[model samples]
Target chain A: MVDDEELTPLHPNHVKVLRVVTALATLPFVIVALVLEVRAFLFPGAFMVPVVLAALYVVLRIPLRRYHARGYQMGEDRLRVVKGLLFRSDTVVPFGRVQHIDVDQGPLERAYGLATLTVHTAGTHNASVTLPGLANETAMEMREAIRAHIRRDTM
Target chain B: MDSTAPTPQRTNPLGMIALAAQGLGKSALPLVAAMFGLRDEFSGIALVLVALAGVGGIMAVLAFLRWHRLTYVVGAEDIRVESGIISRAARSVPYERIQDVSLEQTLLPRLLGLVEVRFETGAGGKDELKLAYLTAEEGARLREVIRERREEEAVAGVAQEAGAEQDSPPIFAMGPGRLLRFGLFEFSLAAVAVMGGLAQQFDFILPFDIWDWEHWMELVAGPGDWIAHLGPWAQALGIMLALASLAVLGFATGIIRTFTREWGFRLDRTPKGFRRQRGLFTRTDVVMPAHRVQAVQVGTRFLRRRFGWHSLKFVSLAQDAGKASHVVAPFAKLAEIDPIIRAAGFEPESDTLDWHRAAPEYRTDSMVLVGGFFVLLALGLGIFVNPLLGFAPVALGMALVLGEQVSWQFLLHATDARQLYSRRGWLVPKSTIASRVKLHSAEISQGPLAQRRGYATLLLGLAGGTLALRGLPVERARALRAAVVESMTGTDFSELR
Candidate 1:
C-alpha cells in the first residue's frame, strides 16, 4: 500500500461538489429546526443553535476533510484507491481482472466536470470498486488504459 | 447427438403422470380432511370417492397442459427454451457460456427411465436451465452434445477425440461401515425438536393444555406417587432412563439421515472433470471442471479433529444446488484428502511456510469493548435489581472474554506463492486455501477503533466464496495486499490451468 502522502489527490473541484451535496443533505434537518423554532418548543436557541452548528460542521468542514482523506494511485497494470476517515478502505484492482468499467457523472458532478470511475470484477465480495472525485477527462483516460490492457492480453 | 435441426421437442409424455402424482400428494391431507367434514352431507363413502377422483382428474389435466406448453430446441449456437401457456417466454443460452451440464433423477423419474438435464451457466440459483423428465438416453446425449460444442468454442482449432470413455477409478467413496461410523459423529437432536414443534402445533386436539405444568403433574400423579414411594435412588434411575431414551432417539435420527444421503456416494475423475454421483432416493450427477474451482476448504469439528476425521469441499463458480461449495469428501482422513486436493491442482500447506497471528492489541481492544458493555449491564442490574443477579452477568462476561482469547489464539493466516491459507475458530475449525491468481481484487479495511489501534483486515475477493484475514497490524495487512496484488496482476488469467 502506498503512503497517504504519495497518493495523487482528486481534482480540486470535487471539494465544491462535496459541499453542495452536503448542503442538500442537511436541508431536511434545517427545516425541522425552523419548524421547531416557529412552534416555540422549549427555549428559542435549544434546537436552533445545535442544528446550525451541526449543519455548518457538515457543510463547511466535512467536505475538505473528506477531500483530503480520498486519494488514488494508478500503477502500470493495477489501480489502488484509498478513502474514508472513520472507516477506511484501501482497494487494488488489477487491470486484467476487471470484467467491465464505467464512468458516471451525477448532476452535481457534471456541473463541476467531475466523474466517478467504477471497476467491476467477477468476485462475489467487493465485486465493484468505485473511485469518485475524478476529472472527467482523467476518468475516461483511465478507462481506456484498462480496456487496452484487457484487449491486448485477450488477443 | 449432432442432429441440430432446431426442432422444438417436448419431454417424455409419461412425465405427466409423475407430475400429477406429485400434485395429488401435496394436497392429499387437506383433501381427506375436507372429505370427512362433508361426509354427513353426502351420506355415503361412494360420494367421497367421487370427489377425490374429480380432484385427481383435474390435476392430471393441468399436468398435461403444463407438459404440452413446455418445449426446448437444441440449436446450432444456443439452446432455447420457450414456455408458458398464456404468455410465451423464450430463453436462449449460448453453448460457449454454459459451464457444465448435470443430471438428476428422483424416484418417479428413475422408475420412468427419465432424468432431469440441467445446464449450469455459472450464474447460480434458478438462472440455470432445466429440462425435466427427458428420457435417460436423450439426457445423456444432450449433455455430451453441449459439452462438445463448448469445448469446440473454447479451443477453435483443436479437434477433440471421440469415445474417450476410460474414466479413472473412483477417487473417493464411502462404504456402509464407514457411513455408520460417520453417523456416530453426526448425532443430532433436530428430529426431537421437530416432533416437539408438531405436538405444539396440534395441541388443541389434546384434552388439556400440554404446556401447563399443573396439567402435566395431574397426568403423571399415579406414576409419580409410585415412584416417590420407591425412594430417591429409584427416582434418580427414572431420570437417567429418560435421558438415555433422548440420546438413543438422537443417534437413531442421525444414522437414518446419514444412510439415506450417503447410500451410494462416489466421486470419479472423468476426462472432462470430477464427476460426483450420490443419494438414495433422489440421485444427482454433477460434473465440475478442475479449472473452474476457485478455492478449497478443509473443515473439522472439535471432536472429529481428535479422531482424525475431516471434510473436503471445492468452491466453484457453478452452484451445487443453492450452495456455492460442493462437498468432495464428506468424511475422510487427511491422508485420503491429500490426493483429491492434488487432483484439483492445489497442494496442502507446507510446514516451511510462515504463519502470522492477529495483533495482540486487536484482542485487547475487543475485550475492553465487550467487557465494558457487560460491566454496564452488571451495574444496572445490581443497582435496580438483585445484586446476586448482577454476579451472573459478571461471570458471563468473564467467560466471553476467555472465549475471545481462545479464538484469537487460533486465528492465523499464511500465504505462499500460489495460494493464500487462513485458519479460524477453535471448536469448528475451517481452513480455506484460495488460489492467488484467481483472486479478483484485494482490500485492506479499517474501522474507527482499528484505525486508532493501527490494525486492519485484509479481504481477498474470490468468486462464490469469501477469504479474509482479520485483525492484522497495518504493516502486515499492507504486505499481504501487495503480495496478493502481485500474483493477481502478474498472470494472464486466460492461460491459467
Candidate 2:
C-alpha cells in the first residue's frame, strides 16, 4: 500500500520562500497602514491604527505558514492534498477523471528548488489537484504517475 | 497519397476584397457619423484629412491586390491554408475532426462573385481557425472537397458513420410575414424608437403629425385627457390609429430583420449531418455532424410557447464560436423534433417525463435559502422604505422561490444505448445528456447548508455540456455516479470512436 521511501522530498527553503514572498508582496498594505498611523498621530482619535495593524498582521501570519508549507500524495486511484489551517482542507481527487497535469515554476520558486503541480480534470469546478512546495524532480515524477493512472483508467 | 488528388489549388481573391470591405463596413458608418459634429476650424482640416485618407485608402486598396496573398491546397488528408504578410500562418484541419464548414458571402462578395469560407473544427474558440476568401465556385469546391473527405473517412471506417437522414428539420424561412412577426416582437425597443423618430421627422404619416407629439405629451401628463377630454369616438379612433401604426411599424422592422439576417435561410440534411445556410447580403453555410455533437437543447420563450414552437441547439466540445456551437432552430413543433435529433445520432427523450428518484433524505435547503432571500429583502424594505411595499416584495419573493424549487424538476435516466441523461432547466430549460463512454468525471458536492439539508449537487462531466443535478438526495447522486462509472468501465463505447 505504501512505497514512501522512493518519493523525493521538496527543497527545504521552498515553503519559506513562498511564505516570505507572499508576506512581502503584501508590504504595500503595511506601508499604507503606517501612513494612516502617521495621519492619526497628527490628528489624534481619528484613525484606528491598532485595529488595522492587528488585521494586517493576522492576514500575513496565515499565508506565511500556509503558503509554502504543504504535502501531497498522488496515489494510483486518488490525489491527496492536506492544506490550510483554522479551516483546514484535505482533498481526494480520483485518478479516473483527471485530464492533465501541469508543472509551473515562477522566478522566485526557481531560486527555492520548488515547482507547483496542478492536476486538471474535465469539469468547470476545480478540475484538478494543486500541490505546491514540490521539488522539481518530484513534480515531474508525480505528473507522470498521475498521467499514467488517468490514461489507464479513462482508456 | 491519392493518385487522383486534384492539382489545382484555386482560391477567390475577389472574396478577399469583400472580406476587407465587410471589416471596413462595421466601423465605416460610425466614422461617417463622426464626421458630422466637428468644430468649424477643424471641419476644413477634417475635410483635408479625409481627402488624404481617401487617397491613402485608394492606394491601400491597390496594395491590397498585392498584399492579400493566400494559398489554399486540397490534399487527400486535409485542407491547408497559408496566408499572412510578414508573419505567415499556415493551418491544416483534418476532415474527421472538423465540426462544420460554412460559406459566407457579403454584399460586396455577392457583387464581386466571391464567397468567404469558414471552417469549424474540434478546437472551437472565439477565433476561427480557418478562413479564406474564395470565389463562389472555389468555395463550393472546398465544401465538396471537405464533405468528400469526411465521407471517405467514414467509408474507411476511421470515423463514425452518420445516422440515416431523418425528416428534414423545421426551417423558419423569414418571409415578409415572419419578418413582421420578428419586428413586432422587438417593437418596444428598436421599433418604437424608429417609429417615434419617423413620426417626428415626417408630418404625413399621422393625421396631425406635429399634433401627435402634442397628444403624446398630453397622454403622458394625464392619460385621462386621452379618454375623458377627447370625445369617446375620437379616443377610440386615436387608439385604433395607434394600434395600426404599431402594426405597420412592426412589419417594416420585420422586413429589415429578414433582409439583414435570414435573407436566404436554408436547412437541410446531408450525408455527413445537418447543414444550416443563411444570410441575405452575406450567405453563411454551417454544418454539424452526428457524432461530434455533445448535448441537445430545446427551448422556447414565453411569447413563443403559445405557438407550440421550440428552438434547437447542440452543445459541442469545441471552444471556439460560442454562437456557431449554438445552432438556432427558428421554429419547430414539439412533435417534429425526433427527426432533428435522429439526424445527429442522438435518440430523443421519451415524451413522458422521467421523474427523479432523489436520495431518500433529500433536503429543501436551497428552497429555504431562496425563501430566506425574500425575507431578507422584505426586512430591508421595511427598514429602509415603506412597510407595505416590503410585504409585497416578500410575498412575490416567496412565490418566486417556491416556483424555482418546483421548476428544478431534474431526472437522471439511463438509455437502452448505455447513455445517461439528466434533464434540468426551469426558467430557461435545457437538457444535458451524455454517453457513459464519454463521461469524463462526476463530482458530488455538498455545501454547509446542503449538508444540513441532506442534499448535494452532482456535476456530470461529458464531452458536450455539463449536466448538473442540484439538491439531489446525496445517496442518489453517489449511486448515479457509481452507475455511470460502472457502465463506462464495464463496456467500451470505443466503437463510436
Top candidate by DockQ: 1
DockQ of 1: 0.68
lDDT of 1: 0.88
TM-score of chain A as modeled in candidate 1:
0.91
Q: Write the per-residue lDDT of candidate 2 for residues A1-155, one digit (tens) a residue.
A: 22232333356666576567766766676677677867776555334566556656755566556654345555546665656543333344556656677899988878888888987755444556577788888888887876766545244
| Model 2, global lDDT | 0.62
True contacts kept of 2: 0.11
What are the per-model C-alpha RMSD values against the true structure? 3.0, 6.9
Q: Looking at model 1 chain B, which ten-residue stretch has the lowest summed lDDT?
A: B159-168
Q: List, for all models, the DockQ compared with the true complex.
A: 0.68, 0.17
Q: What is the interface RMSD of each candidate, in Å?
A: 1.9, 6.4
TM-score for candidate 2, residues paired by index = 0.72
Model 2, residue A114: distance off in Å is 4.6
Chain B alone vs. reference chain B, TM-score for every model = 0.91, 0.75
Give every collision pair in model 2. Answer: B12-B134, B12-B135, B105-B282, B124-B319, B124-B320, B125-B319, B125-B320, B179-B254, B359-B473
Q: Model 2, B139-204: lDDT tens per residue?
A: 776677677677776656545434333354433334555545554444343678875788778867
